[model samples]
Target: MNPWVRLMSKNVANICIMLILPLVFIIIWFYLAKSIDNTVILPSPAMVLQLLSHPSENLISMGSLTNNIFISLLRVLAGYILAVMLAIPLGILMGYYAKIFQLFNTFVGLFRPIPPLAWVPLVLAWFGISSFATLTGVERGILFIYLNNIKLSMVFIIFIGAFYPVLTSAIYGVKNVKKTLIDSARVLGASESDIFFKILIPAAKPSIVNGMRIGLGVAWMCLVSAEMLPGSLSGIGYLITHAYTIARTDVVIAGMISIGVVGALMDTLFRIFEEKKFKWQRLIR
Candidate 1:
């Protein structure tokens, strides 16, 4: 086949896999919905679509929705980013250092049992219904999601989580790395930082990206629940709650659809990052 034709074929296949599959399922869902006739509880796909067609009657025009959503998005983003930043470094350190793992493993064991929601009252009790409460509330909140989710969150609480796996695999990936490469650079007297940015991270990029991709998905899934905490009036979670109060099932469904769209968008962005930035780290093999 011509190169252009081959690429087009691949693109078509990807479209089918990524989009058509969902559409097929949705068609099935619509048919089933019509058969059930329980529009009150499980509205038909058509009903939901009709609801979506209705103009949004938001009370708080520009800033209200923006502020609310921004507040909620910021909270979740802050929590997740803090997690990725704090956890990855700790994971790297603990994975490399046995002593660090032993020291922190006990704390992980202690807190791992607790649910994030369990911290809500205490967070409110201690921090009140202000910003601080919402933020720290999630340190425990997003933890469980990322905890059961991927190795990154687990290691923050303990040593062996992703620490060992990531560390050990990283070491293995590095073992194959030519010793002479680092030795030559060291013989040239490159600073430790140079070696890390130049060698360690690049060499271990594959494993690192895998861990990150998993963690990102987990964190995104946790967004709605994390926003369910009090004092957040902007996110899709808050929107859903607000709509439910007035029995606006359409709005509630719309909020949920928005959440789903955001989740899918995040996933798509991650894939784009993987394809563009981390092509070398792609785990296709």
Candidate 2:
């Protein structure tokens, strides 16, 4: 076959394979809904699709679906970014220096096993309904409303959820670096700074990126649970909770579908970057 034609054929085949399971799932869902004959218990796929089709349409009195999703995205990023910023450097140092690792390892190990939800009681007591608005002293106007929606407790929960995987991964990556690489750099008269940044960081970039991808997924997963905390007024998570309260199964399903789609898209972006930037890692394996 011609190269172009072969490439097109391969792409088409991959797309078809990707879609097969979802088509089967929808068919099964349609029949299941028909048999159940209860919109509250099992809404038809069409009902969910209708809500998804009109993404901007308001759900109940909270806000539009898209608006809720956007709010949730912001919350996830707020905590996820904090995790990356703190975890990477700390993890790198801990992995690189024996004393630093010894100093913090016991404390980290003590807290690492605790689930994010387990912190709810303490987090709530610490932050209550306080938000960015409270911290920044923004009392009124559009910004206040936006900032107030982001409760500190929620962010802390998400940070906890995302922190460990990233921290562990960065530590592992840096510690596992070939000793020869550092030795060679030292023999070449490289400064401590040069060896640290030029050798350690570059060698560990792939592992750190992989950790980031996992952290993002964890952070996103924490969203609904975080939003369920006190003072949450809007977000897809809250929307789903509210829909359930009113027996809006269709809306609940739609919210779930939105979360799945968003998470998959985010994962896909990470996968693409991994494949493109770390192709050598694959080849070496």
Candidate 3:
């Protein structure tokens, strides 16, 4: 067989396998919806699909599904970025230095077990409803509205959710780098900065990226719970909550599906990056 044809056939088989579960899931959902005959309890797949098909259309006066999802994305990114910026550096330092690790490991371990939502009461007490808009002193206009949508309490929750995974991964990656490699670099007259930047980081890039991918997923999950808290007016979580209150199961399902789709897309991008950039890491395993 020709190479191109073989590749095309392989791709088709992969796509078919990927879709099998979802098709079966939809069929089962349709059956259940028909049997129960209760839209509130379990909506038909068609109803949810119809809502998803028109994502731009406003639902239950909580904004369009797309708009709500976008808002949630923004909130996730705000917290997730902060986590990466702080976690990566601290993790690298801790992993590289025994004293630094000892100094912070106990403190980190104390907080690691606490769920992000568990901090809601404390975060609310500290930040209250104050948001980016409050910190920036933007009282009016479009900028203020967007900034105001990002509550500090919500971001803190997201950061907490994303931080530990990233920090752990970075530490593990750096610590696990071959001791011989460090000794070799030292023998080669490499400076401390060169060993860190050129040797340690380059070798640990795969693990760091993997951690970031996981952190992003966790951050996205945290968005729904955060948005359900006080002061949240819009976002997929809020949309789902509002829909549930009014007995609009279809809209709630649509919001959930949107979150799944967005999370999957983001995960796919990370997978692609990992495959392309760290192919050697995969081969070694």
Question: Predictions ranked by lDDT, top down?
Answer: 2, 3, 1
Candidate 2 residue-wise lDDT at 285: 80
lDDT of 1 by residue, 123-205 (tens): 55654434543334444565533322222221122221223333334434444455677788899999878876797667656
Instruction: Point out where model 1 deviates above 4 Å.
Output: 50-70, 132-197, 282-285
Cα lDDT tens digits for candidate 3, 1-285: 999999999999999999999999999999999999999999999999899899899888888888888888889999999999999999999999999999999999999999999999999999999999999999999888788999999999999999999999999999999999999999999999999999999998888999999999999999889998899999999998888999999988888889999999999999999999999997988
lDDT of 2 by residue, 1-285 (tens): 899999999999999999999999999999999999999999999999999999998888889999999989888998999999999999999999999999999999999999999999999999999998999999999989888888999999999999999999999999999999999999999999999999999999999999999999999999999999999999999999999999999999999999999999999999999999999988978
lDDT of 3 at 285: 82
Candidates' C-alpha lDDT: 0.56, 0.95, 0.94
Question: Between which residue pairs do clashes occur in model 1?
Answer: 68-234
User: Which of candidates 1 and 2 is the stronger one according to lDDT?
Assistant: 2
Q: State the lDDT at 112 in candidate 1.
A: 49
The root-mean-square deviation over C-alpha atoms between each candidate and the true structure, in angstroms, is: 8.0, 1.0, 0.9
The superposed Cα distance between candidate 1 and the true structure at residue 71, in angstroms, equals: 3.9
Better of 1 and 3 by lDDT: 3
In model 3, the clashing pairs are: none
